[model samples]
Target chain A: MSRINDVGGMEGFGAVPVDNAEQPAFAADWEARVFALNSALLRRGVYNLDEFRDAVERMPPAEYLDASYYERWFAAITTLLDERGVLPRADLDG
Target chain B: MSADHGDGALAARVRRAETLLEERGVVDGAELDAILDRYLATGSPANGARVVARAWTDAGFRDRLLADANAAVTELGFRAGGLQPTLLRAVANTAEVHNVVVCTLCSCYPIALLGPSPSWYKSEAYRSRVVRDPRSVLAEFGLTLPDTVRVEVWDASAETRYLVVPRRPDGTDHLDDDKLAALVTRNGLIGTAAV
Candidate 1:
């Protein structure tokens, strides 16, 4: 099945924003933390890059579209951890 | 449904996940901090620009970069992928051809070289339209190519990434390495604009 992340040729999105000033590497502290966490997890063998990508791709279409870039990475990291039994879904809620 | 960086719930969830991983011995906060520091120190557009500058000055390096990007980049102390070995392909922009890179499925870019991708690069409008109507998309970025210049859009995958080797601008014969590298921009390396 074609996933929402597979948005190659499909259109309807508005104009791409072009800003001359370079954007900071991370928008916020949380975003940076998410990036670091994802990298650390991947390096530690908690999950491979493809597996994390699959988790991101498996997100619901609306959810995937709604989430920001690092938010999606956070979602995939949580999903992989939950699936791997490293962190149960309930634990995150609690 | 859009989750912004200010979303408290999302931030809380990320923190919770980090704690859980630490408790489970999967990863620690110190290690994660170290990784972030490493990226902050080395990841930048300057790295990619330096590679482009060297390629422009040294024809041998240019040939090696086009032939085997991964190994060639290593010679300059730059690695393509993070945490995994990703094949890097250098697509050169010539007088007759313009090359652009995109990951339709996800934002699979050479982050180590180009720093973080620009927000527009990961936008739905770019990922979906660039492959279909590159000229129109390039026009949106204010890069209007001639009709005779064939555009090639490269779709990056999980195991592979692409970097655009922009053509050297004229009248830069006397510039040193640093000066030439300074002339290259992030957009130029991404093929969204000329250097």
Candidate 2:
């Protein structure tokens, strides 16, 4: 079940890009805050790092591939909170 | 390619989550923002570059860094505590062998040393393929090694982080610390590119 996140040595992954020098530390303000939010939540013991990573692992492969980096974090964290019944759909649907 | 300003829906959802966390008294908005801002300011690849430059110039420091990377970083003012993971390991690339870093499960990296990881590092392509065929992956980064040289791929995890210390390039023997640090790119520190 957790094997989904262990992506090493899998085949069919294409060419690696050459634009590593171009990216900023983060793309947008919200993106940085989202990362910070994960850190904050981890520090506050809302969930452990392993559980957070497990949430990400359980995301659909297609959605995981298409979303931006922090977008995935947002999705995964929201999924985790909702699953735990800590945050309802109404809270995030706004 | 067109720019990505980030997803609006995701941002809105994150905002709502922030509000909820505040309402639940899990974290205060202002306090969290301040901590993130501090990390954003001090955590960068430049910190790693400086560490490499010092190692290149000072033999004693190099010994200390290679022996205990986590503590060595503190000597350069990058203190680790209070949620900062302590198991950072520094690897060196010599003429006979090279090192590359990847996180197969997630993009677990030494953020304080390398700044936030580049998006590609977190991409499924790089994460999955790098460890399998590091030479080819390095080639894509415009680095090709001789057949005689060996490649070692380090998989970073939540418990342990890795930093690459590349062999200093020739013709820089006369350079000062700042000048040498300038030549150490973020990719060099990640072992995808030579300094």
Candidate 3:
């Protein structure tokens, strides 16, 4: 199992005690639609990106299986977006 | 502290919204959920298995599906109507070559059979690369359809959708429905591999 440094995401997740936001360390295409969705989830507090990040930090190398992991991430983010007014209630709760 | 992380509740919410729109004749909720959940759990749709099975069993049905997948599929029993309707045509694979589907515009997948799209399919990299050079892309996924194999790429824009009608693998003729279904993996539909 690789440590947080080996996998290369712990620092990016508001973990690893980042010294600056300017040099944002992120995974590929974080500015894309889905990543935006994840950030929105965290900002809106629908779920805990912090906790999720913590989980990621602790995860072994093999846990990042197919799209399911990413799907779960998207689900968490979308749930928050729906909870907030940014996305309509019907668009989420319907 | 929260109630969303437990299942695919977030995606369910998105699907729920789509369903409401569908109710007002904007989209098809049944079709949307059937498509979405396939990706949520199985990474593919059950209809993929159904299509593959039928293609192997009946030549006439195979011909019909290849000509017009939506119509032939409807004959077998699956809803094929909606507001922004999609017409699914099949691309058959032969010994000489194979066919694969990718929506260059977006990930316009066959929602009728395959539910929601996995993250990889929707990525700009996959959408852009699959059409221009499928052999290289498929190779990255550990699949290489031979040069002899005619690699016809269907551009699945928002207008028309497509699905890969994978050839039945050898030693599968005697297998029953369940066994055959098990063989139809998501990668096979993407023309990345055979079961």
Best by lDDT: 1
The stretch of ten residues in a row with the least summed lDDT in candidate 1 chain B is B1-10
Q: After superposing candidate 1, which stretches have Cα over 4 Å from the reference?
A: B1-6
The digit string of per-residue lDDT tens for model 1 on B27-104 reads: 889998998898888779999999999999999999999999999999999999766788999999999999999988
lDDT of 3 by residue, B89-133 (tens): 777778877777765533567755765555556554565566666
Q: Residue A67 of model 1: what lDDT? A: 86
Q: List candidate 3 segments past 4 Å from native.
A: A1-94, B1-44, B81-83
Local error of candidate 2 at A86, Å?
2.8
Task: Give the candidate number with the greatest DockQ.
Answer: 1
Tens digit per residue, CA lDDT, model 2, A1-94 = 5466678988877877558656777788778778788888788777887788888877888777666777778878788777777776666675
Candidates in order, TM-scores: namely 0.95, 0.90, 0.55
lDDT of candidate 2 over B1-195, digit per residue (tens):
113443675566677788987898877888778877887786688889999999999989898899999899889898533265558888989999999999988888888888878878887789889988898899999899998989999998878888899999988999999999999999999999987
Ten consecutive residues with minimal summed lDDT in candidate 2 chain B?
Answer: B1-10
TM-score of chain B of 3: 0.74
How high a TM-score does candidate 2 get? 0.90
lDDT per residue as tens, model 1, A1-94: 7999999999797777777588988887889899999888887788888898889999998888988888888889888888988888888989
Interface RMSD of each: 1.4, 2.6, 14.9
